[model samples]
Target chain A: MCGIVGLLVKTPALKARLGELMVPMLIGMTERGPDSAGLAVFTEPLATDERKISLYSGLTEEGADFNWLGLGHELKAHLGIEARMAVQGNHAVLTIGIAPEPVKRWIKEHHPRLHILSTGRAIDLYKDIGTPTEVAERYDFKHLTGTHLVGHTRMATESAVTPDRAHPFTAGEDFCLVHNGSLSNPYGVRRMLEPRGIKFETDNDTEAACRFLEWRLREGDDLETALQKGFAELDGFYTFLMGTTDKLALIRDPFACKPAVVAENDEYVAIASEFRSLAHLPDIKNAKVFEPAPEEMYVWTA
Target chain B: MDSLKFDLAEIPLRTVNTFLHQEAPGQGVRKVLITNPDGAHNIAVGLDFPVEIEIVGHAGYYAGGMNKQASITVTGSAGTGVAENMMSGRVHVKGFASNGAGASAHGGLLVIEGDAGLRCGISLKGGDIVVGGSVGSFSAFMAQAGRMVICGDAGDALGDSLYEAVLYVKGSIKSLGADARIEPMAEADLATVKALLAAAGPAFDQYAPQDFKRVASARSLYHWNADANQEY
Candidate 1:
């Protein structure tokens, strides 16, 4: 079992409070998944020519102090460009005024152990092996601001309770996904994507789904069309909450064995695995709360 | 009736559920009022006595599952499996409900004032479910017995693999399942529909028994044939 929560603000006035609003929603799901937690915040976009890359160094060697600041300076020297790095526990968000491909290649060649979480103009991802509150505090989550956010608290069912195995798996540029239930055919799906040259970082089923979605989008299928095709290809009991650069989408399997609830109003669109995660939202009593129909994809765009 | 109150926000869900489990059927307390439920799951489960429970706010999954001889009311919407596997008594939802509203229930009455999600009354053994609004697809899949009444439209593939259960739909049916077909209502069916509608409350008083279409199993596929086995 896992807990998934997402929020998309319609009113720009509430943008600054996005992290504050999401913290409680994430913590409320601590019971669902106490082993690990993660969140992805889509903040204001960078300059059109700039890019941001979020990376994680999962569990450094014991007694070895990983020098994140020194790595930033080395990256600057290696790429011959200025890079600003913000370290949050083992995760780091590096903003560079350069293209992404060359930076990614540099990291791949120099720091082969670092795991790239996501790369985009607006997205900054953070995750760790701890309680939701602990992870949030490690990242100073409540102070972060964004226009929208998606998070997950994961219990180890198929994979180890490592930071990289935590949820909010990202594959496509600025795209991430969190799943609530297990997948029955992830190995088959991985076999399919592997032949197409899609690299996988984790054996987690949600990562397979993320990579599949990235491949679908690469094939020119829109979010709704990709999800509709997912229903036909992916076989399992699942509730998926996915986000793109500008949109948030939700879909449940045909059986809908997993639970999900959506609450929307003029100010925001909020989704959680249960109503308790949403009860504390602003004006929740007045919001239109409903369970999404099975196999039907619902999306909200910024 | 002697009434007891629980504010879920102040008390843990385990505490309230434990209190209900220990309370005797004919004991001093005859009614329970749970305020600020806020959609906590598995509330008031496994009750075996005739008591009235009124949840003042939204409730989560399996609100009254495996109940017996009790009357439960949710003033707001209910989550999935609201009255699953109930043996007796009545469960009423003032607002909408999620999937499997009365799943695998044996004997009871479940009334939903608003729309119900997918697979409402799935695998129903003997319970009677009445929905005031529309129900999603596969409303009564593999139902063995009892009756289901829907005042609004039904989504795609209603009553798939249905058995002896009787379904009465007042609105349009998107499609019927395999071995399921519409049949004419008998006099006894008309009486049953009217009684169920009346039990649903005054809002359903305007629906005449004649406006509904009855659906039942064909009974021809009870035994498997080699030719039909290809379809499986």
Candidate 2:
């Protein structure tokens, strides 16, 4: 039972303050998923204009010094990523849907540890396994600034513990997902998706939903349409939160068995796995907190 | 015992938790009067003391779960799994109780003034539950070793696949399960109910002894399997 939390704003105001708000909510739910924690922030004012770029890099295991900012500059010099940004962590991110699969192939072929967190400017997300506080400290996330963000604290049950196995899984451009329940029919769905040139990096069931939603979105379905299709096709007890660069969506499985609460005010909208998470916010004292309806998808667009 | 009266409407009940790790020393036998506690769940959930917590209104699930020695009494109805897995002490509900009232209880006593719902003592190992009114079906579904006394009517399959628990129903049973059977009310059983009621306070005198019947697990499922026709 991994705990996930996220916020989507109609306007991007607070940068590091958003991660600060999400970090406590993630830590409060340590009992649910004590493994690891990670968060991704999407900020405004990109350096490029044509295509979006997402990068994932970690310094510890790589024996690399503080040259990540320079690496972003170097990658832009060669492959020409339109908008370049790096989410601070021990893992590398990728920008998919670029002109050349060979560039993505070349990056992974050279550095096997860094996987694609997200591609295109559609979404920027991050997730890993560990305590929320520890992960926040490890990534120096207090300095991070963004308008939209999502996070996960993992309690491994079905899959082994690894960075790649953590959430929020990136399937394609502008498509990122986070989940909170067990998917009963993961194998059945995986078998169907894998044959269609869709690749998988982890065995977690949540990645199935991520991949499915991404495939539909790329096929020209809107976010809500893809999510409704996800609710209908998926079977299990789940209450998940997903985001794009412009919108935030909350989804519950058919039965609504897992715990979830949503609070909306004029300033921002927030979703968490428990009431305690939302109750801690000062402005949200009178916030109307309620569970998502069965097989329901509650989406908010910025 | 010093009485501390709280209307609960004045206090932010969500932040008031009597956790084991957060207890102040030498609190003594404090009597708390929680008035107008409308559906506050998990009130004093894991209290590990001898304080008496009297809630004057209705409560939701697991009001006094994992209780060690404190005595908690609710003036109104209780939701499912009330006093669930209580280790010791007493929980008395003045009104009816919901399903799984004392499910998986190891010790202590639960007295319900009115009827109790299904699976009342589903996995009761020890302790004693005395219901003044009727009980729903599957009252003692998987009871291990406990005492359940229902003064009013009991529903179907009263003690299905029970272990060593003793069930006493004062009224008629709709139908018995595989190994549960009605037995005569002996001197020892009557005294046990009388003493347990005395401890639960003033709500237990409504039912007469003659209206009740005693039922205990046959212990057949403990060592013998009927289908296998073998003894372990």
Would candidate 1 be rated incorrect, acceptable, medium or high by CAPRI criteria? Answer: medium
- Superposed by TM-score, candidate 1 places the C-alpha of residue B98 at a distance from the truth, in angstroms, of 1.4
Task: Please give the interface root mean square deviation for model 2, in Å.
Answer: 8.4
| Residue A85 lDDT in candidate 2 | 47
Q: Give i-RMS (Å) per prediction.
A: 1.1, 8.4
RMSD of 2: 9.0
How does candidate 2 score on lDDT? Answer: 0.72
User: How well does each candidate superpose onto the true structure, as a TM-score?
Assistant: 0.94, 0.62
Error of 2 at B178 (Å): 20
- Candidate 1 residue B2 C-alpha distance from true site, Å: 1.7
Q: Write the per-residue lDDT of candidate 2 for residues B1-232, one digit (tens) a residue.
A: 3667666658766545642216421556466677756545677687777778898766666878888888889977676688899999989898777668888889999988877866789889897888888887788888898898887888778899888888888788987877888788898887877776676667676656655678887776677445794554
Global Cα lDDT for candidate 1: 0.89
lDDT of each: 0.89, 0.72
Q: Tens digits of per-residue lDDT for model 1 on B112-212?
A: 99999999999999999999999988889999999999999998889989999999999999999888899999999999999999988897898999999
lDDT of 1 by residue, A1-302 (tens): 88999999977677888888999999989988898999889987899888899988765551125577888789778778788888766778889998898999888887787878889998899888899999999888888788888999998798888888998899867889999999999999999999898988888888888889889988999888899889988888789998888889999988787889999999999999988889888888889988888888899997
